[model samples]
Target: MSTGIVLHHLVDSRSQRVLWLLASPLSGEELQIPYTLKIYQRTPTKQAPPELAQVHPLGKSPVITDGDLVVAESGAIVEYLLQKYGNGRFQPPSEGLVKNIYYTHYAEGTLQNLLSNWRIYGMIGERAPWPLTYLSRIIMSKAQHAVLLPTIEASTAMVEKDLEESKTIWFAGGSEPTSADFMMLLPLEILPRAMGERIPKKIKEWVDAAHRRPAYQRALKAGGEYAYAKLLPEASEQ
Candidate 1:
């Protein structure tokens, strides 16, 4: 399918997932997929810009435009890209339960919520005001050390587990790469910096593997540094 991919970039937000997807296995100049990376600066009041509403009714970042087709929501966009451009490159064969688990179930379900909550609360907590901030921190603390962190730890416990796990040498099940890896990368990348010492070693290894990729490096250079600085302003040099 001939389609254009436009990513609405927000500093240290889920949009980074889209960048990772574009940089992964499906990416190359030859794909002829022209992608527009739109950078949306955070408002002084810490709200998404009203201009985003013009792109889609919800006015959210990480929206993508393919010709006349407009898709909002990160999961939808990633799935669309996989089905449209992926050509079974990133996805495992849809033969059994594992493929079903990886594609139909994983992206939209538990891992999705975990990643979303982890990024939102984890990254924005320090900047948010009291009560709300306190609550978010509590939830993040529990989720990370108790739930999400442990799952990742167990998943990557063995080299065989890692090898059989996903494709793209990241998260999804394949030798190459996929949007699944992209979905998990953003939050995984930021957690160690935000949580510090609390992040598990296994997860760190997973992130290290993803980070070594040339495309991930390119994406980080292209957009992540500014986003990280924006997200963690306290750590940024004054």
Candidate 2:
């Protein structure tokens, strides 16, 4: 059918998840939600280009236009597609639905913020003038150890425990990937490398599984040069 979907994709942004979600196959069938992809380049500073502002006032990525309707935010775009085009796919049954909903928001609402704070602290330290660089690094390191790593470690443990207890690979305890998987992928995948900590074995496996998916590979090829694309050789190694 004709899906008037136009995905405004920015390289290496959360928008990649939207592309993967759209390309994900359900019950051995394609979503067929064909759309145009308007790729925008990030500036040298890694900020989204101003052209995105034309698509949505915030000018950030992970936005889409379905005919006259404009939707932004990774979570919003995922939900919009699931509601209109999912046809009851990529969602868990009632028993798993609550977990699904929690994780869907948790990725951006909770997890990503923590990850961003860690990155910001590091950036501040790196960009500080030479005179202050040493002091800045010490301060940032202290802040990370004091304020961020504890929470981050606890959150990761919580997820690992949940996955272990349920004996389910995906977070929502479903056989196939769900919206929760789509949302959680980036944060979990980036966690170990981003934080320089070894993620729990189960979480590492989950990330590897996600990367090995056909749809995810397709998304990488279509989206172009994702920083988080499965590391060389195999994602399993990382």
Candidate 3:
């Protein structure tokens, strides 16, 4: 008895994971729920376009409009889906859950933030003049090494530990994808581009498993040109 929702999606944004969630509900009519997709392309600088700001002041991707309700932020959108449509699937009850609840917060703010810093410094190094910017490049490299790279390393290790100890290919959920998988996939899928040789086996396995899901492929097909979707060889969609 919920109104149809409108997802304001960006091709390579965190919205991709939300697309997966909508395409693949763990159970019930979540998939059958009426929803529409509003696609936005990034500007030349790889940032969300100004048009998105009209939807909300912040103008970030992954915003949803359900009737008069406008929701922004990936984590909040996931929670909204779970509340309105999940029907107690893909997560545990509100109390006494660790990874399930913890990830909803950390996935966007902490994990993505670390990776963004790496990209920022890399961009700085790229734009720095080769001969004239030698000193600038050194400073940027030092800054990257001193802060961003270490943070990515530590976060990567923490995710590895969480996966290895959980004994589940997916993050918090046991043997099956959860809301955490949807939230966490954004970071893991980018490992090939973000970290390259530093990609961990456990994370690769997790992502491979996700790729194999028919729903994931369908989402990718509809979502269009996800920058990191092909990082690893994805299974052919059936």
Candidate 4:
């Protein structure tokens, strides 16, 4: 299964997005790129395993080594895989059709920001003073209620609206799923745990459709147990 493409994947990380692209139909039929998954388990703290740092400076998951060229960053890896292996399928030439590119980067930029903020905030609260821990939790919760939650609501609503307006089921409005779909999948899949009942029906429908895709399902199986697929009461508690 080694096409000289080695994917350093971590269980239940952003790495799933890259795995989706690797396991996609385009990869097998259109591009014919075979990849080997090098899985790394997260520490009890859920940080990257120490052995991973040897792969690259940060030792982050989703890092791929193509031949001698090592690549990192989920968006960058998706783009590289699409452009190099996509063979004109997902890599559209039309400059005007930028949604694919937009979504690839935007998923990390806009959507993940909300998720990362709360994760860090929650981590900080968890480590805070025994006397101040309750106060810290109250403050973070209030901030989420006042600011983060509303922003997340608007963002989810925006996606729902985009799908409603899209000519296709995906955010890119492409006839077929593109790199954008893979990029968007990770965050959206992770969102349910973060947003819970706040998730809109449109988003749920979109994720459900993506989940049903044979390629996506295959990736899920190969990617190992994805805790993020189902909405858990407290993901941070893990």
Candidate 5:
């Protein structure tokens, strides 16, 4: 067996963020950390494969194995990699530390859950029978507007306000991307698609800039087709 970090990635999922971070520069230099990529395909219904459960009990993507140690969850995998191989990069300074941690947890702890429910509602609507499809869609739409949209808007607005106040494109307000950036990318990209509108200007710009990065491009190339890569600014050109 190879003795490096093994990333079990599910296509078009939050695992893409981990792939981007792995391909990202650890320091000022453009160097990507060495790792083995194990790709998994989602089911026809867009669910993770059962094989993933053998790697972690959750059967989720974005899990990593460093020898005997297994790290799961997107945020935890990001922190673990940065802790072990960051070489003093991808962390915020004292002033930005609090914001970094808040946004990092906020991505998964709050925003992801809202967006996930939105996706589940969409799936429910899509899978409904012909007789119930319209009704189901209406019901799901009502549920989303009631339970998901308000919180999503509030959270995105909070991010917008923070970015506007900081006067920087990045959440942590640093010259380089940090763990917060890695952790937040997936949800931010999903936000606009989920809402159909109400993508705050700053957040849209942030996601665009993230897509245009060299590291992000590299991750896409190596990770095969990602659903969100269509959001790339020059996607038409590609």
Candidate 6:
């Protein structure tokens, strides 16, 4: 297959999973892959990049173009990459186990969305002035921490259980890494950095191990500056 993978990049978003898979241990020089990574600059005035819309009607990040194939959604992209380039390495040996864990993998989006919303609300509450901000915080607090937090907590607990139950270094029954690990690791890796003191130590260790990989480091170097730029605009100014 003479297909090339082009990834729509937005730092710390679902697109990172695609980058991780491309840079995963399984991929090698033999793959003869020529991939393009498109990064969209996030600004207060602008929305998603126009190129994203050309690739996918929704104009979402993490869209990929592989030869004639166009795929959107992070989960579908991960699965496509795994099937095409993974060489059957990341999948579980037992079909039943794969089926069981697949739902947990899917649930990551829900958890991530809740976390993002909470963070957004927190920022709004802290920065926005006057009664409107306070009102917004009250509404978001009830919606997020009160209603959504429990769901995210339960999901995290489930992931922890799966990780503990796994016999191998990765969730997908292998001594090495897999797409499943790549998928789970991105958010798991970034949350601590984004949330700071709120993250637990055990999750920190997991993120550290995953980040130790050369591919992950490459991905970080590739686009991590943008996210860091958001965090510390002074650094960028300097």
Winner by lDDT: 5
The regions of model 1 sitting more than 4 angstroms off are: 1-3, 93-100, 103-108, 111-168, 193-195, 224-238
- Cα lDDT tens digits, model 6, 1-238, are 3367777786556677677777665555656566877787655543566667877899887888888888887777877777787776566667335733574356355656666666776776666677687787777667766766676667666666666666654666566666566666555644543344455434444555666678777777776543521332222233
TM-score of each model, paired residue for residue: 0.68, 0.92, 0.88, 0.89, 0.91, 0.79
lDDT (Cα, 0-100) at 217 in candidate 6:
71
What is the TM-score ranking, best to worst? 2, 5, 4, 3, 6, 1
Ranking by lDDT: 5, 2, 3, 4, 6, 1
lDDT of all predictions: 0.61, 0.82, 0.78, 0.78, 0.83, 0.64
lDDT of 3 by residue, 60-162 (tens): 9989888888999888899888888886667643432678777768888888877776678777877877684777777877887788777778888988888
Could you say which candidate leads in TM-score? 2
> Which residue pairs clash in candidate 6?
none
lDDT value, candidate 3, whole model = 0.78
Evaluated at residue 141, the lDDT of candidate 1 is 74
Q: For candidate 5, what is the TM-score?
A: 0.91
TM-score for candidate 6, residues paired by index? 0.79
User: Candidate 2, TM-score vs. the true structure?
Assistant: 0.92
| CA error at residue 149 for candidate 2, angstroms | 0.5
Q: Which tens-of-lDDT digit does each residue in 98-217 have in candidate 5?
A: 999998898899998899899899889878999999999999989988988888888888989987876467888887778889988888887765666667777777888788789898
Q: What are the RMSDs of all candidates, in order?
A: 6.1, 2.6, 3.3, 4.1, 2.5, 5.2
Per-residue C-alpha lDDT of model 4 across residues 29-66, encoded as one tens digit per residue: 76667678888888998888988788789988889999
Output the better candidate (3/4) by lDDT.
Answer: 3
Model 6 stretches with alpha carbons more than 4 Å out: 1-3, 45-47, 99-104, 107-109, 123-130, 190-202, 224-238
